[model samples]
Target: MDFDPLPDKPAPDNPSGKLVLLRHGETEWSRAGKHTGLTDVPLTPHGEELARNAGPLLSGYDFVLELCSPLERARRTAELAGLHPEIDPLLVEWDYGGYEGRTTKEIRKELGYNWTPFTHGVIRGENSPGETVEEVAGRASRVLTRVLPAMAEGDVAIVAHGHLLRILTSVFLRMAPRFGAALTLDAGSISVLAFYREEPAILTWNHGPGLPLKPSES
Candidate 1:
């Protein structure tokens, strides 16, 4: 259970604690390949099992600030994972808007060509207007401002959706938010963002329950 993968910081006193991301477990929409932004979705029974198991993987870290999206799926995952997290509205998923409940394949078929949320973009929805990738990046920046300080204090964990966390990872790495489209996160996965000598780096990514790092890799 040695989780010592992080490298040394450039400075001793200014060490920033790692940012641990916990993606919420599966919901009906997620299982069905539907876009699940803004709409509140509950976790499936198997999803609850996934959350409970994720708790053990995170038992090593002393998280100072634990945040979860206000969405039910994210909050329920945090709760089941034994995290008493503060509900952070900013951690909600990408505002899929017009595409809220539709799958990417379905959208593409309807449009008669390829349509991607990150690249092709989303229009205003029936309930609320969708957010552009850059807008999501802006929100990610604000979240960093709030969490970076806490990271310096101690490790921080966020329980949220796939798109939101991936976009946040891109922002943290100083990349275009749309770069998140290249990253894929599954339900009930863990990703760690820590410093590599004071510069941001991804320590581990998309570590799902079924995957394991080889001994030498760890």
Candidate 2:
């Protein structure tokens, strides 16, 4: 139920077809800041309220397609946002494997293991193949490829998780997946990313709806 404030400010505004990225509402795992990759947990009560409010916040955008992870949190968020998302497995979070349901600190001390999907690979657990950061990034890139053809027409809304979304951003920016580790997105937050002359530009990141400034105002 604790998270550090955003480490730094969001990127400056730029001109590009808007790609609205929404992280799903909070889960017990997310509220506790534990990795919820592929866990399929439902949203907490507070999370539902936030997701419902997002409908008005994002009503202005002309989203032609709603691509979402099959996980309950994301699908519920998309539904609350007044859109029906076509489930995309690639949109799911990184597989946490043995780390699922456990905090990073707890796992670190318990196993004396310090592994990051961006650097060290996820070990066997959660029925995941223990995918590495590069592998995860490739999956994200495939999603981008699926979405690009539709990008030229209307805005696209991606309802997904924090780490996976960050990885998707890296793929869009043509950066390695490890670079995404530096980009921190909050739970129930919205991010806008787009391209100018084929160059990636991040219009926003880690924006909280419950914060005084709404997404439209920001």
Clashing pairs in 2: 1-31, 1-32
Best-performing candidate as measured by lDDT: 1
Native-vs-model 2 lDDT?
0.74
Judged by TM-score, which candidate is best?
A: 1
The root-mean-square deviation over C-alpha atoms between each candidate and the true structure, in angstroms, is 7.3, 7.7
**Candidate 1, superposed: residue stretches over 4 Å from native:** 1-14, 211-218
lDDT tens digits, residues 1-218, model 1? 11111223332444579899999988878888888998898988878878888998899998999999999999999998899999889899989889989888888989998888888889898788998888877777778777877887899999998999988898787777878988888888899998776788999998877733211100
- What TM-score quantifies how close candidate 1 is to the native fold? 0.89
lDDT of 1 at 195: 75
Could you tell me the lDDT of residue 211 within candidate 2? 42
Cα lDDT tens digits, model 2, 1-218, are: 01112113222333334788998887777777677888788988877877887777688888877899998999999898787889998888888787777777776687677745566656788476656777677788778765665667668899988888988887777666778878877667889887765567788887767743222100
What is the TM-score of each predicted model, taking all chains together?
A: 0.89, 0.85
